[model samples]
Target: MTKLIIQIPCYNEEATLGMTLAELPRQIPGIDQVEWLIVNDGSSDRTVEVALANGVDHVVSFARNQGLAHAFMAGLEACLKAGADIIVNTDADNQYCAADIPRLVEPILQGEADIVVGARPIRQIKHFSPIKKLLQGFGSWVVRLASKTNVVDAPSGFRAISREAALRLNVFNEYTYTLETIIQAGRQGMAIKSVPIRTNGYLRPSRLVKSIPSYVKRSLLTILRISMTYKPLRFFAVLGSIPFSMGFLLGVRWLVLFFLENGTRSRAPSLILAAILILIGFQLWMFGLVADLMAVNRKVLEDIQLRLRRAELNSNQKER
Candidate 1:
């Protein structure tokens, strides 16, 4: 039997929880069972109460606020435990059209992709400022380049993950799961696709991005960190080459002067600076090589982890 679970990670979302739950489809084609799961990330309000009142199948609660990324991962694990073959994660704010859940999961049901993201019309969203839209586009472009995937909405939280894909994902970001997961999917060679999705008007201001500047700073750091984590050699190699290239040019300048104007005419300071920069660049390159080796070890470990999870899932099925 195939099971599909729709999960919402919420905090202080009592106002919109009911509406979000009400829109969820009770049944979808190709799914034997459909269930709702909500992760209460230490909401002080009646978020949990609202979930239970609305007949949510599962409620995972944290005593303290753990942020959206943690809540998302926890919800995924809970759904897996509940025998979900496919899981759809959406926002509690009802920002996305819950009706799109079916379309979001269609790719997974059709075996076309391991993960499917709901791509909203960023430019059309009235709630978003022009800068926000531009940043979203640029950020998605950067993610596409880094992950080598064609995901049009890298920051979209509305996505579906297959059981196998869920097991392999390991998120390190506490701020957000949007970008890191896409990069992870791409690096792991999981098929990822996106379908056009429409968004409801904003009910409230965003809690995730407090300010534009702060959001940009944290987001850039998250992207850079994940890029390095998954592609250390490529990331570091590009960085190392800049200084190396400059040092090479400086050395050439000194050499040309020495040959043409005699040794006395050569700038000793220039030669010394070039040598230091070259050494620093060489060290950075070596670090990249070492990190690449470590990344290989990480991959081997991940493969073992995947096998272990598969075995555990099989054991659980037999027990049931």
Candidate 2:
């Protein structure tokens, strides 16, 4: 009976959504049950009546605003159909620090981690802007090099996800699901950790980084479109090895200027521009070997959509 929901994702945040639900923590230890969801992404006001006068068990409504990565996957499908084993996505404007959310779900209740991420210390965050703390430490070092995963807060929306990493998250990115759900839970090999959380002083200013070169060009095109949708053959063989190593150093400098000018008219336009950049880097490494077989058929259709979302939410919780 682990439970623990705690989502947020609001919009039109009815004045900081009732001071961010008056410091949410219905209780937390090993968390028997600590709910509160929000989602209400289309809020015209009253953010779902201030998230049901601040008690907020669940809401998920969205008649329009549909953004923060589809209100964080519709608050992770309403906290996995209301049976949340653990899923804490904080931030309606109370920039974290709901008493550190039990140190961000204590490494997934000490099983070690399935997705923890709270790490917001970007050079002691005082309203950031040292170029937004060097673009959040170079966008968390390019999402720990496109999610090989040492997640030092890849745009942290204060995390914690396990219900088997929320049935293998998908978040196609409408702009932010906090950096495409930490590069889709660090390239899907889950066990992501981070911890060191705590913040809550900047009540406003980020509607998802309104502008810092348009939030580093939409967070580097959502980490290069989720690293070409989860490493399409090492992102097109490291993008076709930069023009296949500049067409193999320009066909070895046109074969050392044609064996020191013993023949060939002026290196035939430098060996036809090094054979058209080595056939455009071997046709971009054969489009990364057909996009790595369509990313292994999209990981076998995401393992049959995580076994049809756990057999359709355990057959609708055994039909109520």
Each candidate's TM vs. the true structure? 0.97, 0.40
lDDT at position 258, candidate 2: 74
Q: Point out where model 2 deviates above 4 Å.
A: 1-4, 7-22, 25-87, 90-124, 127-132, 135-137, 140-154, 159-165, 168-182, 185-198, 201-234, 241-245, 264-287, 310-316
lDDT by residue for model 1 (1-320), tens = 99999999999999999999999999998888999999999999999999999999999999999998999999988888888999999999899998888899999999999999999999889889999999889989989987899999898999999999999998899999999899989988999999999898789898898998888888888889988888899888888888888899999999998988878675889989898888888888998999999999999999998899788888888899
How big is the positional error of residue 199 in model 1, measured in Å on the Cα after superposition? 1.0
Q: Give one digit per residue, the lDDT tens place, for model 2 in 283-307.
A: 8889878988888989999999999
- Count of residue pairs whose backbone atoms collide, per candidate: 0, 0
Residue 288 shift from truth in candidate 1, angstroms: 0.7
Steric clash pairs (candidate 1): none
lDDT of 1 at 248: 93
lDDT of each: 0.92, 0.85
